[model samples]
Target chain A: MKKKIVVCTDLGPALSLLTLRDDLDVVVWPHAVDTECPRAWLLENVQGASGLVVCFKERVDGEVIKAAGSGLRAVSTISVGYDHLDLPLLASRNVQVGYTPDVLTDAVADSAVMLALMASRRTNLTTSLVTSNAWPAFQWTPFALSAPQLSTTLFSPKRTVGFLGFGRIAQAVLRRLTLGFGVSDAIYTPRPEAPPQVMRDAELLRGLMPNLHSLRAVDMPTLAADSDFLFVLAPGGEATRHLIDESFLRRMKPTSVLVNNGRGSVVDSTALAKALKEGWIWGAGLDVVEEEPHVGVKHVLPAEQGVREKCVVVPHLGSATHETRAEMARLTVVNVLRGVDGEQMESGLDLGRWQ
Target chain B: MKKKIVVCTDLGPALSLLTLRDDLDVVVWPHAVDTECPRAWLLENVQGASGLVVCFKERVDGEVIKAAGSGLRAVSTISVGYDHLDLPLLASRNVQVGYTPDVLTDAVADSAVMLALMASRRTNLTTSLVTSNAWPAFQWTPFALSAPQLSTTLFSPKRTVGFLGFGRIAQAVLRRLTLGFGVSDAIYTPRPEAPPQVMRDAELLRGLMPNLHSLRAVDMPTLAADSDFLFVLAPGGEATRHLIDESFLRRMKPTSVLVNNGRGSVVDSTALAKALKEGWIWGAGLDVVEEEPHVGVKHVLPAEQGVREKCVVVPHLGSATHETRAEMARLTVVNVLRGVDGEQMESGLDLGRWQ
Candidate 1:
């Protein structure tokens, strides 16, 4: 008898779970729209499955492992971060969790730079001036539409780009900034007890950027005070919650621009809004917020209106590109198939707790 | 006797005519706002002036040239394109024209890439969703907001970048595309004369861009057919007006993106609108339009509304950056000072017609 593998969402035939139909019993939650499979439906359909597939939205906890019973061998998710899955519970059940990583680094890094440009260039204000039929009345002055210049030039000599976390995505973002803007120097927060490989990676980045004279690993206060453009690419969770709060915002240069492509909780939206309104920072660009996907002009607080006016916010689309998403889907299917075959999963969680 | 010079706009002291106030009598436009000096003001104030400084907004016609009354040794503009100043007319009066070029190449190229990424990534649509409080109700699907990926990945391997006219700005853009996106190949329309130096530059570009195995000079038909991302960086004029019209748009692949940072008249808004509406192309990002600052969502036919929906339209801000604008102003001042001092202008127009 073929082992059952249930996919929580329909991934279409090109990246479908049904590709394993000959060797495994494949059950797909059928939906033609852009929504998650209902929780009730997932609970009912996940029974007696050897494997399960999920995207970023689903929260697979102890209940999910219980529903899959003793048969589940793998929990594969189509995202880099396995935040939604309770890894400890999965480990307890001997179920290895699989995730898609490195595949999305380029797309997310591209997004971070885009957000930085949008904020510094004031694209939202300028584009609205065109769409609202207000351009004719507006005059073109030297500084009329001018905001902070993102790239270095003779007039704006030094470009100090800082990263909250110097990881793969942040490194890619740094490469683009250096190549396009001729950035002079960089500062980033180092992880505690960083592996020697990460140190070599930082050195490699310094060599790649043409005008970059230095790439220093700095403390938080120095990073905030020195960076002309500060990018948050740190991981999400309790430790990083509100890392960029009122105190941090106050320490940042008044002319600095803040960008967040990391998880929402890392930045205190209310504090950021107040900072923008109070002119503590020039502008901000956010891809994630505390109440994201539900973010509006008033999502965080009444002060959140400042984000709509002074910030460029996009609904968590750091990896929302055709190539990246498709690759993620393909990897998801592969992870599950590999797990069921008793072969090591391609990117299975290396939780020492499981051993 | 100090030479009399009239500056049409006040470039702050950093790039101001006031810098030459001790050497020449400088008359600056009184207003602090972002508008061009009125034509009548220019005609009246230009009397007996040895040099006149102007931006793109001022039309240097026979009337203004005639008002200077033979004392105008130089007519310097703080812009690259001399479209606003009639060269033939200036040549007739022996007025040497000076323009700032090569200085702004980086800023404009940066804007071009920004626009390309914005359009292909659906930034406008996604940003609007966040600001309008619409994302909560919407579901997150794999392909719902998927756009033509700007970069290469395993799932989408090939990336073909094309240029309508390969000039300095285009070259800079190609460099960024190659470095950031890992593009595979490039195609560009060589100038009719096809100088040996131009061929050398293309070879140099291929060397600079890693993963770019091929870079070829192709004809118009092949350029349209082969490109995945088509950039119009050609000069603007009647000869190249509406170059990307119905036929060229039709020839383009549906997945191809059209970006125009060259000039307004190069891409016909009507044809581009139609192309986007019918899905003849994926999307477009335009920083320039025929009508320019006067471009409203209603500027073209009602079909043109499709541009507002499917395209990313920024105000004519290709070189609106603070650093670039300041440098242009300084160059304009230097050109005027050099012309007045009987020294050759830093970048004077060699109008052979004067001889």
Candidate 2:
């Protein structure tokens, strides 16, 4: 009998995996919409499955792992984030975990720069002025809708940028800033528990951000105080949650611009909203929020209402590009296929920490 | 007696031009509001002025030139575009014209990238979904708002960029594309009325866009056919009016992105609106429009209504950054001061063509 593989979503690339292997029986959620499969349906159908493909919308917790039994050899998700999975539980059960990374780096980096420019230039406010038919009410002044320039030009000198997490995506964004805008200085916080590749990654970062006259990893306090454009690229979890809370925001330069391309949990939205309203920082651009899809009984939440003018909030679209999505889907299929065959997965995680 | 100079707008940098010289008497329009100085007030106040500093809002016609008499040795505008000034009349009367250029290149280039990303990523539509509380109605599908990536990633190779007028600002934009996004090929339209400096400029362009495997000058038709990102950076005036009309847009690839950081008149807004509506091209980002400050009795013009989703329109805010505005103001002062003293101006135009 063929091994059963269940996919929680019917995305094109995910669905295509159903036809990839004749030896595997693939079951996909019936819904055609862009939504998460029902938890009850997934639990009921995932029984006796050897492989599973899921996204952020589904939680692959201990219950889901237990439901798959000892026959579940591998699980691959179509996302850079694996927060929904219980790595320790999967590790103990000897089920290899795989994820899609590096593929979406360029798309996410593009979005980081876009959000930074939008926040700094007040594109949201000014665009609203045009779209809301309020352009006539506001006369053109030298500083009417003016916000800070993202990069150096003839008159303005290069600015110092900071990063909370200096990873591949962060380095990609730094490249755009230096080569595009002539940005020259940078400050970042070194990861407390960095992997053995820190030294090599540091060297690689210098090569990528060539225009930087200074690139130093400092403490969090100094990083907040000095950076003109502060980017949060840290991973989300309990340890890093609310890393950019009120105190950190208060310590930042008044003229500074904050961009959060990392997990939404990294920033305290309430504090950020307050900071923007009280003019603690110039502006902010966010791809994620603490309580997103922020849809409650009323649909959209009121958390972002007061500070909408000073913020450029997009619906968690860091990797929402056609090329990036396709690549992610391809990697996901490859990982699942390899794992089910008991071969090494292409981008499998080393779950040794859990062991 | 000290030479009298009148500044039509009381903006900080323009007003500060008055204090730049002790030998000049400076008069400013007294309204504290952001609107332009009343035409009658400017006419009455401009009389007997030996030098004038004006913005785009005020028309510096033959009437104003006659009111100032022949003693008006210099007419310096704070803006790069001198369309408001009657160039032929000024040149006929031997009046030297000085305007600020190169100072705001970074700000404008920054905006060009901002708009391109906004339009290509469908950020405007996505952002509005969040702001208007309509996100709940839309499910988070894998390809709901997916558009083409602006930069080269692992999945998508480098894109070919085109330029309608490859001048200083366009070159600056190319720097961002090459260095920032890793864009590889570029095609431009060489000015038919070529100056001697075109050869040197071409060489310099090659040096700036080093990542490009192919960089060549092509005819308008070929440029339209080849480019994935078409930039309109030509100067605005009668010679280049409506250059990106129906035919040009029709020739462009449906996946192509059109960015205009140059002039309002260079593109026909109606044609662009139609093109966006019918899916002739992918999207457009315009910092300037044909009838800017596109205001109406109802505020937003009907021409821009149908295609708002595919078009990212910013008010003429290319040089609206604080640093750039200040620099342009200072340069305007220097130009006017030098022209008034019968010395060559820093960025004085060669009015010889009009003469």
Candidate 3:
């Protein structure tokens, strides 16, 4: 009897992983199927499912675990965060959980930096004027939409950088910011008792940037007030729900830029919309939002209604690179195979009280 | 008695300068009306004229110089180049001449760098897709049209920068390119016997970039073949006409980018258009053209028709910055004043036979 597995969500590079195991009976669901299935469908479909590979959209909760019964031995996700999995139920069932992490740090960091530059420099706006064929007829004066001069000195004379959560992605973004964009001072909010790796990374980055100043931990108010550009890189969990609310945005400078490269649930979209319309910030570049993929015409609020006309929105693509995605798929497959073989998994999530 | 001045070619800035000297009487022509003006009009306009302010657009040939009659002592131009002025005729007539220079360097350098980055990174193309709503419907794919990954050190293993001419503006642009873009090697075309100041500047720059490989002089073909990006900054004169024709462009790699900040005549536009259309090179960014402000649908050739579609073209705004333009205007005023007072001019053009 071969081990059976069910793959859910849009399996991008993940599909390649399934081809590696010849002995496993792999069933791939390319579309997001609804949880409720006909009685005959469930009986025939998941009768021999020994493992499950899921994405953020699939709700693998208590009911799904009960449906798999005792045959399911492990569950793995193709994402860094495992919020989609119900840890309590999976632990009680003695099911191992694996995820992909740390592989996407550089790609996400690069995207964050690009967004910051595009927003601050008004690249999208000026390029639009020229490509739309409006430039030749439009009367252009000297001081029209122009790029802000970014000095190459380590210490930027004007702006400061702040990170909502001090994590691996945030640290990578800071390194690029200081070296490439000449940012100096940085303020971040860290979890209690900062990790040793965070301190070591900070020390190494400081050595590279001679003029780096004030890499201190701060509260939300201080971070909001000091940052000319704020990068949100914290994970989405109950503990950090709505970290950036209306009050936090109100304290930010009107000329500041806000970028979101992490889980969008951490920021209140309505509050950001209000801030942009009210002139509380210069502009924003968002790669992720609270509701994604389905961000249609409804998501695009009028400039006067809430979001500023200058705000540039991008669909979630922080890790959208050929090299990065292939690496992620390779690592995810290794984690799944290790869990199934009863070996210690590379990136297994802790079950804590549920165990 | 007051000194009389005749103004030609829109006496806006020149009229303002004349207002500073209350002892001088300024006369403006209603329509470049020198040819149409009767002898009575000339007698009335030039009863005591001793100075003339002319623009490049106006014809100030030998005939016009004699028409101004014997009283004219000096002729000043608001422009930097004096191709329109009959320099030999003025020298024979013993008429002192003045023009503006060294003031528009910073603005031109800024535009040059902007074009370099835009062309190299495909900013114009990507930006057009985003703003025109031509970006495909949002899908979480591994590859998307996003800003190029600039922070990664992998692509630029050993970056090299090259300049065709090492003039004042080119040197300034070199400073920004090396510092901001992390370029190492800097090769430039050599002048006859490098001046001590030029050697000293090169040494100082080498110190700034520890990884700088060499700053040696090279031929045109070698410069194009070896450089990742090339900057054209040579003067536009008969001696250097069409210096970067088809053969030079053919030597460049497909990945290399070409930027033209010098006079348009220095580059053969027809050759560049063909190069872009045939994909001989990646892309080009041009601020100056052979017949600028006159390029339109009819001027484009069928084979070279796709050049504008692939290239990023800007109206001649190389020296249109607010700060640089103000400085140029002020320097032009000073040049005019010096010519009238018979004092040494700060930046007089060297109109010798060799120059």
Candidate 4:
């Protein structure tokens, strides 16, 4: 008998991997009206399945484990983030967990730099001026709507980029800043436990960020005070929540730009809105937000009139590129295939770390 | 004896250069209500002036030349373009012409990239959604606003950047694309007579664009068909007007992005709007448009409802950064000072080209 697999949602052409394999039986949810996979449907169809492929919206937890029973060998999610999954329960059930990481790194890094560019130039206000039909009356002046330039200029010769988290995504962003914009100086804060490793990785960092002149590991306050462009690319969790609040925003240079591409929760929405209104910082570009997807008129971010001028907000589009999403789907399928074959899975998360 | 110099407009603190030199008698137009130096005022004040400093709007033609008469030794404009000036007439009078160039190249290049990012990601539509209070009702999906990613990805690994005009600003943009975005391939079209130099400058180009693997000088059609990111960074004039018209835009890939930062006239606005509406091209980021400051709801570019999804327009803010404006003002002052002292201006244009 063929081993059965359940895929919670359609991953487009990546489902062609099923036709290539005759030894496995794959079932995908068929629905045109729903936004994401429903839990009741997933629980029912996932019964007796040898493996399950999930999206970010579905909960892969004790309930999922109980539904899959003893046949469940692995669970895969098509996201770099595995927060929706109950890792401790999955590990307890001896189910291998696979995630798509590294592939989306460059795509997210591109968006991070995109945010910086859009934010610093104040495209948020400029675009509004164009779309709102206000450009005709806006008398052209030499310094009118003049915002900071991301690339180094004759007057602003030196540029320093800062990162809230030192990781693959942050490092990729550093390479772009150093190579693309001629930004030579950089500072980043590592995870609290990872502080001592910063000095040992100088040579490694050189390989990652070419032409980087100064790469200093600083504290949160120092990182806030010194950086010309500060990027928040850290993982989102309870511990790292609200890392950038009122005190941190106040420490930033009045001319500096803040970009958060990592986790919206890493920044305080209320504080950022106040900062933009008060001119605590020049502007901001956000790919993620605290009340993202559900963000409305009542939200603190879009509520303030002054914030609209300085801040550019996109609807959580960090890894929303077509190429990145397809690659993620391919990786998600490979993980389930490897797990079913009783071999080591590619990009498998270590269960021991969760314990 | 102090030599008389007439400054047509206020250059902010860059006027301090005038205060530093006691040997020059400077008269500035004092009316704050007027947008630019009024024609009558310029003609009146320019009489018997040793040197004339102009803004982009002021025409330094036969009328002003006749007023200044034999005393005018030089003319400097605080703009990269000298279209308003009667360059041939100035040359005939043995007047050295100075215009600011090279200083604003990087700042413009930065804006070009910002435009590309904004255009590709459809920030034109996304930002409008946020500002217009329509974001609340916009349902979120995995690929709700999925747009092209600017940087190289594993799936879209090879990126080719194209330049319509192979000048300093285009080259700077190429360097940023290659270094900052990990784009390895580049192609550009040179002036009608400058194609042979492309093969000869390989080594020099390696220094300019660090990690570029391939650089091609190709015909217009091939460039349109092949380029992923096409930048139009050429001079604005009748000779180059509508260079990227229907035939050129039609040749572009349906997914390729067009960014014009050099000159607005080079692109045919009607064709681009039609292309956007018809899906002939994916998107466009324009820092310069044919109808720039006067762009209202009646303009063809903004009038097309379908165009807003893929087009991002900013009022001609090519070199509008605070740092760049200050530098341009300072250069404008230096050019005037040099011309008045019978010294070669730092960035004096060669009149031989115009002739």
Chain A (alone) TM-scores for all candidate structures:
0.92, 0.90, 0.84, 0.94
**Shift of residue B296 alpha carbon in model 3, Å:** 11
TM-score, cand. 1 vs. native: 0.95
What DockQ was computed for model 2? Answer: 0.54
Instruction: Please list the residue runs of candidate 1 whose C-alpha ends up more than 4 Å from where it truly belongs after superposition.
Output: A13-17, A154-157, A192-202, A300-307, B15-20, B154-157, B192-198, B300-307
- The global C-alpha lDDT for each of the candidates, from Candidate 1 onward, is 0.81, 0.81, 0.64, 0.82
Write out fnat for all predictions, comma-separated.
Answer: 0.61, 0.55, 0.06, 0.55
Docking class of 3: incorrect
Which candidate wins on TM-score? 1
List the candidate numbers ranked by lDDT, top first: 4, 2, 1, 3
How close to the true structure is residue A286 of candidate 2, measured as C-alpha lDDT? 87
**What's the lDDT for residue A138 in model 1?**
80
Q: Tell me the TM-score of each prediction against the true structure.
A: 0.95, 0.92, 0.63, 0.94
Q: Write the per-residue lDDT of candidate 3 for residues B26-96, one digit (tens) a residue.
A: 77665542222233444456444567665555556766777777766677765677887788887776666
Model 4 per-residue lDDT at A135:
80
Candidate 1 chain A, which ten residues in sequence have the lowest lDDT sum? A300-309
Q: Provide the global lDDT of candidate 4 against the true structure.
A: 0.82
Which scores better on TM-score, 2 or 3? 2
Give the TM-score, chain B only, in order for the candidates.
Answer: 0.93, 0.89, 0.83, 0.93
* Candidate 4 interface RMSD (Å): 2.6
**Candidate 3 residue lDDT tens string, A260-297:** 88877888878888887887876777777665544545
